[model samples]
Target chain A: MPSTAEPDALSAGAKRGRPGYDQDSVLNVAVQVFNKHGYDATSMGLLAENLGISKSAIYHHVPSKGDLLRLALDQALVPLEAISEHERARTGTAEERLEFFLRSTIRVLIERQPYVTLLLRLRGNTEIERTALERRRAVDRKVADLVVEAQREGTLREDIDPRTTTRLLFGTINSMVEWFRPDGPAGAQQVEDNAITMMLDGLHTRNL
Target chain B: MPSTAEPDALSAGAKRGRPGYDQDSVLNVAVQVFNKHGYDATSMGLLAENLGISKSAIYHHVPSKGDLLRLALDQALVPLEAISEHERARTGTAEERLEFFLRSTIRVLIERQPYVTLLLRLRGNTEIERTALERRRAVDRKVADLVVEAQREGTLREDIDPRTTTRLLFGTINSMVEWFRPDGPAGAQQVEDNAITMMLDGLHTRNL
Candidate 1:
């Protein structure tokens, strides 16, 4: 929960060598810890201690543990939000748009890796968790609509249901967080490209 | 918590006028109720009352609340255990084995629907939950080993990492318990066929 106010306290209150740690830097560390130990298991006190700051000092910018959750989910939400408005997604043939949307999503998830990972792990145990789940499903429904659009355009196989396909596709994408470690063997671009190719091959029309 | 001890008592304890009311039938009702209310949320008192039996009579069959969980997880674990030794799973080509594995997994999961659903939702808070999770992961790792084998054989896509692919595939398959109702629009066969087709198409050589 280290927010802007806590950083202000470092300079204004009693602290030495506080460095240039800002709200975002603190958030980065918090997300890493949250991903490592699940949200329920993580405590604000642990986060503050990790930041080498007092509990009160950590309360400057964010209000509570849930505030940090909202921020993390917001980060995860923006990329898919962008996808719906992207020109490639909006103006292209159904296959082209769908592929672009998917590839872009994978890329965003990789780049925002930990935040998206945290977002993916929410289980609706709290209000923030419930909201995150809802937002995720909203994104899912939008993607499903795109799939349905592809079906209507005769661009996807008629045999597969769009809703089921979309769930499988996103399920694959959402799972990136579980295994894709940035420090691991595969590079981000490599992961995104490989997933996109496998997905496209699975979903695209034979003629295409 | 019904154990082998009180089968006679459990059977004799059933209400009269229903010819088929036996311990198995009673256990079926217990499982459904347990699943709906959750293990911790349910009590023997509530269960016995639901069954129109005295608590002592209910205790004649099951030893404790945990016994039901054992039975439920036991039921779910059987199909998964069966798959590891499946003839086709062992002797076939990797792709063939994986396809059969996927199809069979879906069928088993559907057949053991309530039990597996309970297994899937376990939070790992108790010894039971942790054991179930460990076992589930062991089953998962077995599948992961097959993916690794498939990758080594050059049968599956080498572009996407096998572990990631396994998680994604299982995530999709597991999420079925969330929305898949037996009496819904799609029957079990329809779901199985579509799931396999989508998975295979996504998994197989694109040009094929």
Candidate 2:
């Protein structure tokens, strides 16, 4: 995934006197606006006004508002799909692999929060959204599979159903998007560690 | 709180030749449409169309779409506020009280899933939304206080920050709105039990 922070090399090279915004920068602003206003309520005019660029300038980057939506959704989904298919996520002991998956998913959520937030709120009103939802479900199923494997391996508790375990675990992690600020009083590392400990060790004080 | 399943007695009594809907039923359909299409995007025409009633019929129930928004939001918020202020929630040991809060919260979220879903998705774009957001924050602070008391009483582990713990615990519980079907294989009782066990006991197998 291209970092929104870096200049878009391809766009920069292709256009002479390109508007001050690159595709990544436009996407960054678009995701922010989509998040602030409901996606269905956002228009290209509103997006351009927020971008401080002409409608034609935005068109220079992407063909339509739908294209921006697709790009923005990919920003969140691609990394998550990568995590599910990562060699380490695939090869480790189920317990080890599950931890890696949880930790990695948290990092992705924090890094791509705006994108992920938009992705989560999607209602599948369009074909692009439905396709994105499918990819998201596929990732969810992979994580659930890991939970099942962990339970079967006896490294994790078997009392709780694995699918329920996956849902609760991801639910806890995803809830962070509501209030977690990368620059908040709690650093990302602290938030991640606290979640891991709470998930693995439970919140009760151990007698031993 | 009046159950949506029950007819709206006041509205039923007030009107002659009342449309086939009551206030609770109108609010119920309004909340569903809002959840599906979003609060801002939904208009009275769309709502009336979905409800198979005239726009006048919807207006008979509520003065304006904004009124419906406030009413729908309150349907979710009022119950949550009551939970925080419930006598049992206030009287028990912090650990026991916290458990009650969690269990009661899960029950409310399930019973009022659509309303709560609408509440959670509020963007605070209007005065009513901002007010609802404030009420939500207040409830969160109360829950966090219970966590602080639990940790101080040596029931909950001290390593995690009480506020973060509260957020994660509620985050885990609040997440049930996403995919937890009341009619699904897992009953509400099972979901409540699994969440309580996961939150209090951790998910790892006990070695002792």
Best by lDDT: 2
| Candidate 2 lDDT over residue span A1-208, tens digit each | 1233445556662465673667778899899889888688899999988887789888988999999999999999999989867789878788889889999999999999999999988889999999999999998898788888888898788778777888899899999888898777888888898998888778888621
lDDT of 1 by residue, A76-135 (tens): 887868888878888877777888888889888888988898887677889989988898
Candidate 2 chain B weakest ten by summed lDDT: B1-10
Candidate 1: where is the Cα deviation over 4 Å? A1-22, A25-59, A64-66, A121-134, A202-208, B1-61, B64-66, B121-130, B148-160, B203-208
DockQ of each: 0.24, 0.62
- Candidate 2 at B80: error in angstroms? 1.8
DockQ metric, candidate 2: 0.62
lDDT of 1 by residue, B123-181 (tens): 67789879888988888887788777877776776666676667667866786766677
Lowest summed lDDT window (length 10), candidate 2 chain A = A1-10
User: Model 1's lDDT to the true fold?
Assistant: 0.73
Q: DockQ for model 1? A: 0.24
